[model samples]
Target: MFQGRRRPWAAVSLFATATCLLAACSNAPPPPVVSEPPPDAPSTTTSAPPEQPMPVEVVVGVDELEGGFNPHALADMSPTSSALADLMLPSVFRPAEDGSLQLDTTLMESAEVVPGTDDFTVRYDIQRQASWSDGAPIAAEDFVYLWEQLRSQPGVAEPAGYRLIEDVASRRGGKTVEVTFERPYPGWRTLFDNLLPAHLLRDAPRGWSTVLDDGYPASGGPFAIRQVDLDRGEIVLERNDRFWGEPARSDRLVLRAVDNARQVEALRSGDSHMALFGADAATMRSLEELGDTVDLINMPRPVTMELLLRPDSRGMSDPGVRGAVTAALDRNRLVEAGTGGRPAGQLPAHAQVLSPSEEAYRPTEPPGAIPPAPDPQRVERLLTEAGYERSAGAWLRDGRPLNLVIAAPFEHESYIAIAETAAEQLRAQGIQATVVTPTGDQLFGDMLAADPRSTGTGGAGSVDMAVAPRPAGGDPASMLASAYGCPGVSPGGETPFPYNAAGFCDRLLQPTIEAGLSGEVPFDKVSDEVESVLWRDAVAVPLYQQAQVLAVRKEVEGVRPGNGFAGPFSTAAQWLGTHADDDGY
Candidate 1:
């Protein structure tokens, strides 16, 4: 039923075509017709045979399938495609429970950092037994080819660590690779994450961008693409027989693109085995509506929803005002209101550099030993001290009402609720604030711009505040390099300068951030120093860590909740198929 190539092997020639037309072949004895067993017949064998169970198929629901199958393509780096990449691609390194990078023994036998050089060098011993589904052996050349493409080619959004590699040589007759970096790249483990088969992609005609648009030619992971039907809004993946590791438990996997509103219905009607989406108000209602049909699993996300303020704005330019706003907000109440009154089990965030799930995270607080609670009196004192007076239930500075504009995403339903709640809190303290739901381009481009001249079509003069999610990868240094470093600093200079939307930049902290990113300084020391700056300046106010929620059917098994880059399908090889008679996972 699939409309694409089913397997890597060539089509088989079952019989000789020309000789079958001969008369001698036609005159050969006709095969006798097989007879069926009689209905009343007894057991013919000595004993009755045991019944065999059928192979299982799993259906996973997603928000949409808007991108291509090419994992290397920039457009396919969206959330849905990233989920699919976990099934078809093999990574040499994976994130451990403590948010640290660990080498995957299935792909690499060993990885060690070589010393005694000004530039950093790491040697990776590839597993000789690992091979792609197309039958090509996974070798050092795959890494070399991927590195070359990422460094020289276009379309890759973040090629930071890979660009620093001066050379990648194949030693031990192509079984090992020696990567010598031009600079110290502490996040080297995140590079070459999804290696492509060198034999298929090395000499690609359409280059890296469009080569795999039709579908992957081969896969190194547990599953391979069998069909991609855009019309039906589904992609079917089959177990890859050429996989060297443990084979997948399920026979087939179907990723369905369903709307957020219809996901609960799909699970209850037996159309989907699992679904993960934003825990918004509608999803909360749907979870209550679904009742006992599906189970909801909530986990901490490596993302944070924070209020990013523009220091160049009206009253927000003052550090006292920023501190007052931070003190006025009760993060515990905001967390409950944001997640529909705590059924989702979300946690309030205290630090921006690391999530509570991470081991290196520390609770950052302002100096002077103030209690961590809403202080209305302190808010009035700070406002009155900053050339403002409370008159007619409004704070007026220089004969003008102190008005603040908060921008949030128009598409994210949860963000809208958070913005509304924050606006109400600000207004309760005699500060006039308005929440505006703007497009992503307007929010990220115009409102979050470093220079006012580059504002987008939104025409927003000065954006006082915006609420958005910040991605924190396995390495915190790599994530916070631009935001926490100096005015013009990044990890290996991968991103542009002025990355922090809050416009909080300190020249003294640049060396510390750089040292942390390059592994020259201890992480604990860097974190302590960074926390002091964050708490003292009131750089950004963290609301809560976003929660990744999943709705799974009762019959499904081996559903491991994932954080950071890995999704639910990361451990597909160990997943068991769902059965109708099974009670629960």
Candidate 2:
């Protein structure tokens, strides 16, 4: 028989007694007073009832809230989704101020690694009172559901940790959970961050994509979805009365979507209490004009900007050509051009898998003592070695000019600027290059994801290079695998994984990446080797990490900048409105 933590009967009894006393006090009138006042005495003046406090509501302005709300799915990995998840989901572990994982005791009684000889095991003791707003228990089934979907789904945020899970066992009427892993995963804490409700979503019609599309069926955190009005560009979150832990400080939270200028204007005009957006120089200056009424802070976003060279493209097929292209452009220049006077607080990305803001980030040196600065000599030498001769200031191979098409999403201004700058630099270095604007879906899904074996030299509608963003997460192993691993077959074995944007996979390095992800080897042991291989192949040139800005009025209390992954919404539960009394009514 499996022994699990028992509910506190003593505490329950005491709570019952207190509830009975409160009910009696309210429902039963005091025993009839034996002494009657003198008939002639004036009747005692009746005291007036106390005034009720007004509810507090905080309105926040943001860039947009137009993505699917599923936090685990790739298509929903936007700022809006992250913010919503932080406000409505339950997690066993949450990020601390130092970016370390800490057990959320309100949600779990205990969560720790269990002793196992053959396989790794983790035991979770959920709080007895922990339940969703809809009265569903937050238990082992939720963990199992998340693990199953993430490991099998096509476009998940990071499935490496979940893939290592062998089985999830339930006990104590589904309150206790035992998870057995195939290997010793160091990044286990990263799993099940935004656990979905298994009872509601286990058999949804559209599966993972439709999860939280309009509103949550139930909420496990301090706030619940009151309304999601896409047409009105607003999402209203009300305090979850069923929350077992501390209640939200504010009565309601309003997330209002608006443009950058409008976000600043709302904050200035006091229409919104706070605003978080990707601000340009003009917007930053506008916020600065608010003086002491507001405080502006830079918040790190979980994305890195990179110049991806598709190995299957015509100009990039040869390793030498790819190396030459990588050597010809300067990362600093690219960052400058991409930021374009915006106070993005971007740092030149040095590692392929981890962003500069990450705790485990270590700069990877370029191959063969290659300097960080652009080297024209190295570019010329590499191009010549690849059998390309300089003719009339342009490299040509077999009477064909070495022309390349660089693509960027038409909606992303920063990426477009970076692409144009790269084109100018390549043209200056005697390489024929042109910039093309394409929709993000077309650029990423169709152009960059083309398989070399079938495409056969990348015919029409193929881009030789792209300026895009690569998302980073808490788990380094998962980040490495998602960014560079070989294409995986779907659960049905018909569809292929389409997230590997590099289109460059080395057979020798695949084993090392797998070992790191599965915990057969330490991530530190394999990350350096994999990064070296990627640099040698010139898979991509990392430019900088993306960032956002948050401006909060002085009246709003308890709002702080969150970690790079979760943004400001991580502390949403603690946000108090301007009208909140000293008692936080």
Candidate 3:
């Protein structure tokens, strides 16, 4: 449902230009003094005094840091932001754990969509106490400005998630806000992104983007972005003394950047408080040796693998090749490889997507083990019958060679392996396949340029096969829409990933899935219906899903790791412990 969040570290130090008070008068810092009670004071070690609870500082791993920090301009949505969205901005109504829509009363007092119309035409109850970091009263127009800004981010992908809003009107009384839509859309409730400070941003010279991109001076969250120092590699967030809810307790929280290799060095040398995303297995194992020093958080997703069939793909447009290809692929092996150094799978006959939580997933290997037999012999047989046969030890057909070009993004390691596997499988079938590595930006650009309707890698030319992660939601509609929706797949043909690289266009599947997206019908039927179309059309193959693993330090408290997409802090801030909870020891 979302692109997996990956962050590249950049040097950001908030303390470089800080205004810290000098020791004594000038220079000569004050001496460290213990705050021990006077000698006459009674000792309370046996029956400890009720000490006030200290604020917990949570430092979790992020695969990639945020591309942009602004709520309005951020293009790549990260779970950190999704989690921070609660602290930073607020949604009118959010998706709940049970897969139902529920209201967030923090910003708007109340919200309800107009029945029968995709346009929510929602009515908002104002919270007068709500104020931005700059001390300006929160207003409905703040939301209005944010709406226009997000809609005008100057790129096609910018507004893809926000297409439901038709218009917004906040009246003069300053107590209400209304959103009207062009048609019936169920995702409308996701539109009311919590407003940024119109006061601080409105007058900035470089527009809002520059202010937040370079530095944030105003916000409604628990804290405002205080400073960024590139040299020390850190960003500091200071508690907002004016926050409406319980203020964040930490006076200053820092986000540092260190690679997985150096993370162990950072931990051993006492250079870091917590290791972030991109940590390798070796680093984690090393941290385990130190014990109670590092924390890990695991975020779960239903699945993160997708099929790459070109509906408009040439030659492959034939159902036989697609089906034969499906029958040829060893999905179990592919699934196991998707997760880093781990075996994972999603059986075709089952409803569960690779999980220990669901009783239906029976493991063939020991827990957390990838199997060795990927079964290539079975793949060879299927292609032989499809007229693509091995000739002179190479796949060839009708005096021509069976060839394919796969497009893969480097961000996800799985795509890299899948591309290689795809090449191998095609080779076994006597087909020659080439894998192309395109930068993230270039991959999408190439896909957008291709004529989506043309068969065989259709378009201006971009991809043959693309491996993408499809984050599953509680409902099948979430999974189905991402893989089979019309907007997802190009009508013109194969483009590139995130977009239906397969360019599958099933008129029936699209509308039915729409019904589910708009909450018209149950997604279970949508899933059944779409899979049937995929089954008949053989539009795309379903590879195995992915499971994310996070390692938490023992000392970290109230750290419950659940599905963030399901609910903000689903398990966050509840699991209380100190560096002593690293159960392994």
Give each model's clash number: 0, 0, 50
* lDDT digits (tens) for residues 163-211 of candidate 1: 5578899999788999998778878887777778888878878766567
Q: Distance from true position, residue 58, model 2, in Å?
A: 1.2
The TM-score ranking, best first, is 2, 1, 3
What is the Å distance of residue 70 in model 1 from its true position?
A: 11
Give me candidate 3's TM-score against the actual structure. Answer: 0.66
Writing each residue's lDDT as its tens digit, candidate 2 over 1-585 gives 012256799999999999888978796777686898899988988899997766688889987777468877644556788888899899888887777888889899998898755788888999999999889889989999988877766556566677667789999999999999877887888877888898988877765655567767889999988877888898878889999999999988889999988887788888899988878888888889889889988877787888988786667888899888877887778888887656554567878888888888888956553347788999999999999999999999899999989988775677899999999888988999989986654555455655644554433226778887777757788788877887666544576655466777677788898889877888888888888888877888888887778899988899988754667787888899865342221
Identify the runs in model 2 with alpha carbons over 4 angstroms from their true place. 1-54, 207-215, 312-315, 328-330, 367-381, 388-413, 416-452, 456-464, 487-499, 518-522, 563-565, 579-585
Model 1 clash pairs are none
TM-score of 2: 0.79
CA lDDT, every model vs. true structure: 0.70, 0.79, 0.52
**Candidate number that wins on TM-score, 2 or 3:** 2
TM-score of each: 0.68, 0.79, 0.66
User: Which is the better candidate, 2 or 3, if ranked by lDDT?
Assistant: 2
Stronger candidate by TM-score (1 vs 2) = 2
lDDT of 3 at 504: 58
